[model samples]
Structures are given as C-alpha cells and as structure tokens.
Target: MTADRDTLPLPPLAPDMQAVMDRLMAEDGVQPDPTLLPPAEGRAKAEAANRRWNGPAPAMARELIVETPGGRRAFVFIPPSDTGREAILYIHGGGWAFCSAATHEGAARRLALATGAPVITFDYRLAPEHPYPAGLDDCLSLWAEREHILSGRRWSVSGDSAGANLALALMIRLKNRDLPHCGLLFYGVFDADFESPSYRQVADGPGLTRGKMQRYWDFYAPEERRSSDPCLTPARASDEVLAALPPLYLNAAEVDPLRSDSEALAARLHALGRKDPFDTVPGVVHGFMQMSIWLPQAEAAFDRAGEAFRTMT
Candidate 1:
C-alpha cells in the first residue's frame, strides 16, 4: 500500500497527539514529501517543521558547543540546579540524513530537566554526502573525548530513531571496553529487515513508513555492507555483544514501523536473562517524543527514561 497519509488506515493517536499531527499536516500540505526531496532541501524542511514543537525551550543553566574531529559540532544542554556528575549523550534521529542539533535543541533541554543532569547532542555527518562510517565516526570521536568535554561526569547514551541505532551501535563498538552506564532508546531503527511484522503492518504511515526507511538505509549504508556491518544494522550484532550492553530503557510508539525493532532487541535481552525496561506507548506514531511540549505522553516518556537512568546510575 502507498504511504498516503489520507488513505492509510492508522490506529488512533492520543487526542493531544492527534491535534499536533493535524497542525503539522496542515503546515506541510504545500510541501512535497520530504523523504523524496533533495537532501539539502529535505533537511531544511525537516528543521523548519520541528521548530513548531520546540516552542520556547525549557530554561537551561548553560549551553555551549564543542568542536570535534572534522570540525563537526557538539552541543551541551545543562539544566538549572544540576549538581550530579551524571549526564546524558543524546543523539538526534533523522533517518541518518536530515535534522541536526538545532532541530533537536528543545528535546535535549527537556531531557536535561527530566534527568536533572546535563544533556549533550551533536551534529553528525549526514548520508548521501558522507555516508556510513562518517556519522558513526563523528559520534565515536565525541565519545572518546566525553571525559574532557563533560568534566568527568558519568554519562549514559540516549537517542531516537536512527540516532538510537547509532547509540546501540556505539555500545557494540565498545562492548569490550567502557560501556555507557545505561541506554535510553526511543522507537529505534534496529535492523534492516523490511519484512518484519511491524514493517508490513505499518508499511504506510501516518508518520514513518517502510519505504522511507528503505531509502534511509540505502543512503546510510551500501547494500553490500548492510548485513555485515554491525554498526549499520545493530540488531545483527552477536549474542556476546548484545549481552554485554549496559542497562537499557527502551520504548516504541504503537503505530511506528520501527516498533518491532525495539521488541526484537528486548526479546534478545530477555533471553540473556536481562530485565531491562521496555515500554510500548499506545496511541502514538514514530518521533512523537519530539512533541513533548504538546503531548503529555511525550513528557511522561522522558520522565520514565530519567527514572530508569537514575536507578542504574
């Protein structure tokens, strides 16, 4: 089925989420499908669309940028009254092609408040220009210098969608070294399998669609390397790597095509006798957490993730 928003049958979204979606749809009515646009144009449109939900960001005690390798940027969001040594490294999701630290500023601020600790986000290289190991390398560069930049704080990793994929991949890359204290993944894209149950069920979306995701994969990883590269498709990581990951807090939107990815990861962890928390938020679509300013469920999800982080730290 085509991913036509008007004709696709979708599960009901929460009232607030429905209202937010309606407003976004109206605003985007004149624009072509971003997924089909040129990378630069698509990035611009995605950034502009996210600005609405970011609404007067939650106050931050401080904000700053640190330059990483390749002259890429990393942004730090520090909440008021934060005194702990714990922090979060938040990675923004945009199918590995669109969005940036600026588009995700509000969500990072909210995360800082939710966890009562500083939150850091960065601008990784986008695909179809840099592709594959480039973005992951940028993330790794920042991680290597986290101590100097974060002032020796104990930090966990957190991300949404493709960002979550990278976060998990980072963990796999560090499986034999120092891992993050915990992980908070939201509706992450964990695997490349387009035939998964959720993929077929939500092939066309009120939000994320299977076709869009396929394009994202094509841009991010060459077909020859997709299945073999654990960093590209993290779910394919070995059982030893999976079992060695730190504590995790995962959630999936009920109507998201990526929902099953989280489910599969959680199941793998369970089989390893790990009791990590996995929440499935009903009545929402992928990237709903970006609407935390307008959706209570979004805020609540952050709160829950914060709680999970605290327990592990």
Candidate 2:
C-alpha cells in the first residue's frame, strides 16, 4: 500500500479505524521524527496518547504493584470476574526504549476483560541507557522469583512489538525449563533484517517506518553483537530452538513495516513442524492494539487472540 505525503497513504482503513487514524494524524501529525527523546518525555507523550485513545478502565478491576527480585516492581491487573488462578504475563512495547506498565494499563485491562484472565506487566530497563540484556534480565529475574505464584493455574507469555520480541526470546532462553502453555505475539520484531518485502513496501509508513525501527534496534542492541544474539533477534534462533516452542498466536497489521516479521516467523515455525495460527489485521497500522476502543479491527484481533488463549490454556 502506498503512503500519502499529507495523510496516511494506503488502502481504505476500516470505517471505525479510519476515524481513529484521522484523529491520530491530526493530533500527532502524519510524519514522526523517529528520534530518541528524553525517556521521561517519551513516556509522558505515550501516557497522554494512551489516555486519549483508550476508554475508561473497565470496572471491577484491581491493580497492584508487587516487588520482584532485584528490587524491581511489577504491575498486575485483576479483572472483576476473577478466576484467581489463571493469568497472562504481558510485556508492553516501546522499541525497548520507552513506555511502561502504567502507560499501557488500558490495553492490559482490555486483554484481561477479553480473555477473562488477569494480566501482569512489568517495567524492564529501557535501552540507550541500560542497553541489551538489561530488560531481558529484569524479566527473567522476576519470572524466576515469582513464576510459581504467577503460574497458579495457567500462565502464558504475550506481548506486542518489542515486547513480543522479548516474549519469544524468553521462551528460547528457558526452552528447557517449564515454559508457558502458549504465546500471543502481536506485530513483533523478529529479525534485524531491514530489507524484507514488508519493510521495503512500507519503508515510509503511517505509523512505524523502517528507518524508525532501525533506530530502535541500534539503541537496544548495538551492531557489533545484534546479529549473534538470538535473544535480541528471535529470527536468528536456530531450527532446534524454533522447534521447541509452545503453541503461538501471531497477528500482523496489514499496513505495517513489521508485517513481514510475523510471516517469516510463522514460516519458520511451520518448517519446524509447529503449524500454529498466524493472522493479519487488515486496514490497520502499527500500535493498533492500543486503539481497540476506537478501532473495530483492534477489538476483533483481541477477540481472536482471546480464543487462542482460551484454547491453549
């Protein structure tokens, strides 16, 4: 799909999503700078946008901050109709740079409401300051310390964008350990390759672009070690590692630079005999999950994902 100079270029978006995109373009503008900003400011902007896009938090939900190992804290969302045992460990995406559990609370609440399970999200250290392995270490540390409690009934690992990358990486890291029952990856970054067809086709985008993603990678994983670290780039995982994963549910935005990542990963999984379900959300852009309140496609994607979660758990 072609991008427009003054507006979001491409095929017509879902009627409901068109309005959400229009509002986003009007508020944040068509072209993004893609430059790294002060972490605090980036977080503030994300929080404000999340506030505007997501409706009020669903009622009968409880939120708590629990201390994890290494003095880090984790955020958890418990739905009103609590089952008390099952939960999902959701990781938020901000290119591994910005955004925290707080900024992404609305999406967490929506996931809990849709799946009928509680959700837990944590703050991993951001990059360009903490760099590679820092965020992953935080997640692993917390999981190691609290997996028993979190694994009460059924627990799965789920995330979007960089968060999805981390989720897959965690599975690879703990492949021999007690892995999650399933995974839900939404428009993730699986490889460092910038020349994929989707990247070339959507180089300049309505939301995320190839150049912006490259900048994110550079800040998170330096050029010297990125290619060698499968954890940093899950696509680099060997066939042996890919074959050991649990059931996965993946979805890509029809018009997104990272669209190819999901396709490629699905192909890899298929080749390894893990023919899991992979889907695409047509007429949407990156970060569409956060727009569930306004975009029908986003809600539909979540509903499909909820079904996958239910079937696996």
Candidate 3:
C-alpha cells in the first residue's frame, strides 16, 4: 500500500515539531502498540501525552464539560478567532476504546486554525464496560439536545477512524428522525466486515493491526446487537439512505486497512448518484494523526483535512 505523503506532499512542520520527530527517530526500541486499553485507561494515557504537546501554531484549545442528557462529557473547545463562525462537532477515534479530549488536543487546535471554525471534540461513552448502543446512544443523543446551545447556527460533524464511523452513523440516526447536518467529514473510517481488500493487504500495518480491530469490535458490539444497525457497519446500510444523506467528504489513507471502507463507501455513494467528495491520502499509515511527533506527513494530512473543511462551512 502507498503512504499518505507519497500521494500528498504536506506542508512544512514547525521547529519544535521537527525536534520531536528527530528524537523519536533516534530511539531504537520497538514502539509499543498505543491502542492497548479500555477508554478510561487509554484516556489517562492521553493526559500524559498532553505534557509533550508543543501546541498547534495557529489555534488555542481548552476543555469544556458539556452536560449531555445522560451525563457530563469532556468537550475540547477550540474557538475560532471569529466567534460568529460555524461550529464543528468532532469525534475522536480509538474504536471507542481509547481516545479522549486530551488525546485530540493538538488535532482539534489545528482544525480550528485551518477551518476558522469553533471545534468541539466530545468524550462519548465507550464499550464492553458499557456495551453496544450505550456509546453510540450517547453521541446521537447529543444531536437531539445540542441545537439550543449552537445559538441558531448551522453545523457540521466530523471524526476519524471509529469516530468517523460515529459521524456517519450518528448522521444516519439523525436523518432517520429528520435531523440534518450541514455536512460530514469522515476520515479513516472502519467498516464491520471481517474481510476487505485493505484488511488482507495491510493486515499487519503499523499503528493498527487486524487482530486489534477485531478486539475493538468484540468490545464495541456483542453478537446479538451486530445484526441490524448500520451505524456499526455503515457499508451495510441501504442505498435509499445513502442517496438521501447530506453532502459528505471522506478521506482514506492508502496504507491503512480501513481504507477499503472509505473506498467502498465512495462507490456506494456514486452508485446512489450522490455528489459526496472523497480523497485518498497516500504515503501515511493508520493512526498517523497521533504520530505527529515522529511523522511530518501525519500533521500535514490533518492540516489538509482542516483546510478542506473550512470551505464546506
């Protein structure tokens, strides 16, 4: 599989970021798999990573505690310089296993910088401990209850990896109830199928592996619950809904196993006669967004995603 940088020559990174990259490359030890725990523990790991954050050059970030219908959620708030700008509802990906408002700090800040839109990344419930629908329910429930807080402005929803699935799924859930998002930006999304081209091709891709993905699904959706909902497996969704869906833009990394899901989804949208946008970022691996320390390409992709989103808003 090709890397993201091979397909996209990203922008130059800052000096501190370059130093961080150098230090990481100088190390000789094997990199431990980072996605190795449940949400709470993984999120704890993120806070530790926060200490190393050099901060994005263009934007500022702060965490907000949003009171959802079910309970409190940690929302990382990145206000655009323009307060009157559009708002972004973002979801972080860890297959609903390990991800937090802290983990996405730099990424959210960069997003705000590029889009000039207020970005809010939420900490939705995770699975196994909570199980199927519990986490998904928390995210969807947000849509029903958050409009009043937006001050009558239109909005967009976006997320990466499993979080991307959530964006697509949550929108479907919303559309079922006749609610609409101005647009959707989905990146590196995973589908429920056990077999796909990338799954077989990049079965052992760095940052993410096949066995680990299966483990996440095992934790996210138990057997009885896997049968019907397309949210967990958006590819399994019907064409009728795909056609009715709002404008969407999907980004797929060539070296990631989940690339197939994005490709398959693009195909489905085309077959349904939809005009959703799609792009394939090559020369990068899965989870590169978090690899900003060692991978310049990852940071660039994040920037590109942010810039592209600004226009849609």
Candidate 4:
C-alpha cells in the first residue's frame, strides 16, 4: 500500500553521499520497485547495483568458506597482522530477500579492519523463498557451531537492516543459553509499523521507501504473524527480553524510513533503565554504510561503530 507523504521534511543528503547516489542512479537507471520483480530478477538486479560500491577489496590475511548443512555458505575475513582473539559475526542485509556474503564482502572486510577482529558473514536463506524462521534458524545454526567455527575467540554480533533484525531475534532466542559480548545493529527494521513518523516522512524515497519495506515484510512474514511474532517484529518483544539483551550499539540513517525503529528501540531501552548507545548519522539515506568506499560519512560511521564495539562492556 502506498502511503501519503507526511509534511515532515527529510534531512538533506551529505554531498559525498549525494554524489555516490547519483552515480548509482546513472548506472542502474530508473529501476522498477523491488516487490514488482520476480525474486530471481530482484536478486540479480540488487547484486549488480551493489557491485560498484564494493570498490577495491582490502587485503585479508586469510579467507575461507565453511559449508554447512542445507548448502549454507559462510565467509570468514581474517585481517592482516595480529588483531586479537575477538571475532564478529556479521550478518548482511538485503531486506531479508536479496544480497549475500559476496555482496557484503567489502563491508565485512572493512569491519575486520576497523575492529581488528575476524568477521564472519554467511548466506542466510532469502525470503519469498525461505522466509521467517528459515533465515533465523540458519543464523542459530551458525551460532550453535561457533565453538568449532570461532576457535575459542570471544565474539560480538553485528548486522545491517534485515540482518540486524535477525541479529536481535537470534539474541532473544539465545537468552536462555549463552549470549554474545555485545550487539552492533545498524539501521535495523525492528517493527512492521510502516506508519511511524520516519516512514511517513520518507514514504516514497530517495532510498528505502515505505512501500518497498511493506513488500519486504509481506515477503518475510504473514500479516497475522508480524505483530505477534517477537522474532519477526522485535519492537514487539517484551520488556523482560529487551532488558536481557546484551550491551548494544544502535545507529540509524537520518533520512531513512526505518530511522524511528532505532529511535523507538533506543527510547524503550532508556525507559527500562538501560543506556545502550544510539546514533543517527545525518544527511544519509538508508543503508548508507554500503557506500563507505566513496562516502566519508559512511566510512566514519564504521569507525564509530567499531569504537563503540570496542568500548562496550
């Protein structure tokens, strides 16, 4: 459903960010709505569009792929030099439908550089194909095998957009078991409520419109389950569960429709007396970090996220 644009004006894009956006638009041309394309076509188009932003890949000291059951593939990026025993499980975001480890390799490598930790990113099953518990279960499966995979290194969890949503849900599922050291979530889709202030303000888009997000939700979760399933809409998680979450570093893009998701989650955490750090990077669109190769603000945001991860208790 198309939402009427709210009178609230969006913040302007950073100059560098605008340049990158313009370059992408020129290359990709005016594209059809993602929800209108077939799943295969959508995935192909997304991968192609993202390929340009990947830039020059940073040199990894070591890289390897681990194959698990059900044909799931996990990529490990080990930074050069002695980094330390800490590791990060990086979940790539593509609205729970498109993108994969290869698509996010550049960002994951940059994360490894910034945090001085090996970053592990995997191909979780996508939506309109796998959906909901299928993707979450894949993440859980990797966590289950962490002992074997991480080689006794201390680890934190990090994700972007839909991946961030899965990261939080994974933490919720593991609350009864062992927990990660912390969580670094970026511009996450925490709720299914598309009429939130940010969504209404940015209903159409320079990027990440409310309509596309609504379609993504439909692909990932049935309407009846969205509000009821804590794993699907983590904003609906109980206060107890929220309180039990590990130290978190949350950030949102100023011009994103999902910005309020991070804000609302941060506010709720504050109400519960937790002081997780939340940042809103101004003058950028949703998933701006993907352009870190060419955008100074995006690169700085990664540095900020790494610093937060390092300082979190």
Candidate 5:
C-alpha cells in the first residue's frame, strides 16, 4: 500500500532535510519492518545510508567489543581535548530493532568533540528476537559492570528514539544502585499511549507514524505487558519514582510523532517539583540527531546535548 503523499501531514522539513526524507519515501519507508530483513542486513543498509548522510567520521573514534553479560559491541569516541572526568554512553535509535553503534557513530563523535569527553555507544540487543527485557538487560549489565568500562568517572546515558527509552529506563532501574548517571534523552518513547496529541497531529508521518510505532511497541513488549511495566512505559511512573530520577535533559523533535513523549516526561518531572530543561529542535523530525552531517538543526541539537552533558555531569 502506498500513502497519498500529496495529502500527508508531513513535517516542514528544511531544504537539506527534504532530500533525506525523499530518499526514505523513495525506499518505501512509510512503515518500519526490521523483522522482514535480518538485523545484520538492516544494520549494514542503515550504516551505508548513514555514511552518505553523515559525510565524514569523527577523527578519533573506534569500534570495540564489550563483554557485558549480553556480549554486545560498542563504539568509543575520544575528543582531542579530553578530560577524564566525564563520559557519555550513547545508545542508537532504530525503533529498538534496527540500526547499530556504527550507524550512529557520526553523531556520537560530534558529541564527543563538542563535550570534550569520551562517548561510548553500545550495540545492545534488539527486540522480537531478543525481546523486551533483553535489550534493557544488556544495558543494565553494562551499568552493573561500569567499573570495567570506566572506573571513577562520571558518566551519563544518552540515546535517540528507542535508545532514549533504554537510557531513561536504565536511570529508573539504577536509581538506587549508587551509579553516577544523569540522562540525556532525545525524542524518547516514554509511554505506551498511542493517542497523545503529537501522536494524533503527526500520526501519519513523512518519517514515523502512529501505526509504525505501535508495531515497535508490540515487538518490544506485547500489549499485555506494556501497560503494567513502567520500565516500558515511563510515563506511568509514580510521582515518587519520577522524583528519584537523576537530572534529565530532554530533547524532542518539534515535528515528530513522539514529540509528546518528551512533553509527557516533562510534565511528570514537573509534577514532582523537578525542573529539567526540555528543548525541541525546530523544523526536524525524529532521528534528527543522526543527520547532523547535513542538517544544521541536528548539529545544533548535538550542541545542546553536549552542553547538557557538561551541565549534568
């Protein structure tokens, strides 16, 4: 089935961004389907696409394997002017089923350069093959073994899309574990609700849509489990739990189906008398952070993320 492109409520993409969206549309990206193509193939395709959009890789980044309990691969980016005090553990977004650490290494490298700190991105397990607690558990294992990754260093967790979801959930999971983590969430999927205002307004997207996200949720945690698990649905968190979270820096795409996810998170935090800063990158959709090579707004968003890392840590 093809969408009526003429009438879709598409985001007002920037001049440069129009090209990227055009490519997706040409490739029939209306709905996401990582299941049809194996994850390795999907990741290779994404890495190729990202390389074209990402222009050049940051000079000081390398890929390494981390033997978490789950045994995932990771990309580590080092800044030219690095201090050993702070680091970022970035997770890439692919609806929790696609993309990889290599696919998002460009953005991570930009962040490392901007923050003057090392940024480590993990290739965590995905869903429908590994499923819900699997991906989250892989992240948690890394946190449990953070001493091996970086001992005595202040590190913050950050991710885009589903990666952001993991970052937020890990903050909650490790809240009482005496870990030093502040969260940098970029257009996260914080709730199971599919009827939020942004979901309605930007539902049938030029990028992400209501139906596509539902598919992702179904793959991550079947409907029966999503509602009852606050880890999967962060918005369902109680005021006390929300209050206990580390200082968070929430960034959202102004014209994104998941925009309200960030708003929902902001509201929950405010209800607990916490004042976390939320910034919406204008004229872009979800996944803008990875398009920094061509999109100025993406670069600007990374600048904000770097500043957030500096402020939070």
Candidate 6:
C-alpha cells in the first residue's frame, strides 16, 4: 500500500493562510536531485513558499562557506552597519529537518536591518538523515569559531521554530563548555512531551497542526535514538540543565501549539530567576513569519523580538 508522493495531502493549515498554502502546494517541487540533501529540498520548498518576498535592501547578506576543524558548513552573512557593529548568530527554523540559510533569507535580511547587527545564519544539518549531534555540531562550531563575538560581548543568538530548539541546545552545550550565552527564540519548541496545556488548547488552530507536527518529527527523528537525546527534544532534559541556560527572549503565537512550551519553560526559568523575556504574540499562528502579509501580527511580534534580542545580549 505504498502512496505516491504527489498525492499526499498538504497538512492542515490556517484559514487566513490557506491561499498561500494552496499556491505552495500547487507548485510542488520535483523530487529533489539525489545530490541534494533532504534538508536542502525542504529549504527549497520554503523559498518557493514566499516566492514574492522582496525584503528590505540588506546592507549586505550573502552565502559563505565556514570551514571548521569539525567540518565545512554553510552560512548566510548579513553584515551590520559599520556605525555600531553588533553580531548575531541566526539559526533558521524547520522541525530540525527543514529550512536553511536560503529558506530564511527574508527574515535574516530584515533582522539584520532591524537589530543593526551583522547576522550569521547557518544551515545546520537536518535529520533523520543527519540525525542528532550532527546538526548540533555544526551549530556549536559556528559559535566556537566566533567566541570573540560571544564572550562578554553583545553577541546574541536567535532562531525560529526548530532552529529555536537548536539555539537552546547550543546554550546547554556552551554552558557545558563553560562559555557565556546570549540566546533568544521566536516561536520555539522547548518540550518533547507535546502534551502541555498549549498543545491541547492550540492543536487545532491556524498554522501548525498536531498531525503535521507528528509528520515533521517522523521525518526529523530517526528511529534508533529519538527519545534518548535531549538535543532533539529539550523538554526531556532535566530542570537543572534547562535552568542554567542564558537569558532568553522566547515568543509564541497565540494560537500555536508550542505556545505552552514557551509558557511552561518561561515559568520554570522565572521561578529559578533566570528571568528570561517571553512573549505571546496576539492573533498569530505557528510559522507566521513565513507569510507576514498573510499574518500581519507577525511583523510586530518580530519587531518586539528584535528589541528583546538587542537587550538580552
């Protein structure tokens, strides 16, 4: 009973966003060339999703090759205005399986302009193919090579969706290495259990859906080691480890299932006096930033997030 890829249903989506989703589904990418990684294909789809995005004139943002002792990884560099050169290591979100430096070009360019920080956005390895630790390694290597940027400096870290998850994983990794952190998240996933209150309350709402999330994890989480690693799912990590993370600016869309992941984690951090900044954007849905015109509330949310990222660092 094998199913044809072309016939697969598009995931349940937000009504406000249905037209865009329909258009995206219509121009479906040919199955990727074998030379391309699965993550690369996912990124292509995201770029196609916003084919009309002619974002701000970036000061300067371009693809870069970062060669580290660990390995060669790709990044998109958005240089800050020379007036005051701050830097942010930006991670683009997917469910740890999709999106990349290319998929998130608009957000990166706009973010650089808004925060006035040179942005280095990475294309971390995505999973079930790359699996755990591979993507994590790429993420940490980008930061380790830039310690001068992160140490007691105004260097901030930010990402949306699964990249947000990677950001937190990097914080934990940095702490373990006895390094400093400046991590922020936009509509992040902080838990793996997925049964938190927000999950139940917003599961059927616009944007992200429970069934779709399950599919995302299916593609991202390899069978052999899915539950054992905290890198893939931070909620499974102990509270002590989660508390030691750096000051964070976490946001959630009002109708996003991950909203509770943000709320619960923020509460824990607040209780422990981590005092991270967390916000719930009104009238927004999961992955709203991908279609700002379709989800106007996201622009304001992103603006507020930029402010928080500036201050948190």
**Top model number, TM-score:** 4
Query: All candidates' lDDT scores?
Result: 0.85, 0.80, 0.66, 0.87, 0.77, 0.66
RMSD of 4: 1.9
Give the alpha carbon lDDT tens digit for every residue of 67-181 in model 1.
7654656788889968868888999999999988888888899888988889999888899898988888888888888876677688789999999998998988887687888
Tell me the TM-score of model 2: 0.90
* Candidate 5 ranges beyond 4 A from true positions: 1-11, 23-48, 61-72
Candidate 6 per-residue C-alpha lDDT over 21-78 given as tens digits, one digit per residue, 9 for 90 to 100? 5654576633332213455665566555544453543456444555555564545455
Sorted on lDDT, best first, the list reads 4, 1, 2, 5, 6, 3
TM-score of each model, paired residue for residue = 0.93, 0.90, 0.80, 0.95, 0.88, 0.76
Tens digit per residue, CA lDDT, model 2, 76-175: 7888876876888898898888777876777888888878888888889888788888988877777676654354566788999999999988888898
Mind giving the per-residue lDDT tens digits that candidate 3 earns over 126-203?
A: 765776677778777776666544556567777878888888878887765644455545455546664677777667
Q: Which of the numbered candidates is closest to the native, going by highest lDDT? A: 4
State the number of backbone clashes in model 1: 0
- Give candidates' CA RMSD values in order: 2.8, 3.3, 5.4, 1.9, 3.7, 6.4
Tens digit per residue, CA lDDT, model 4, 95-196: 999998888888898888878788999888899998888999999889877766667788889999999999999999998677888999999989988889
Model 3 per-residue lDDT at 162: 81
lDDT of 6: 0.66
Q: Report residue 39 deviation for candidate 6 (angstroms).
A: 7.8
Cα error, residue 207 of model 5, in Å, equals 0.8
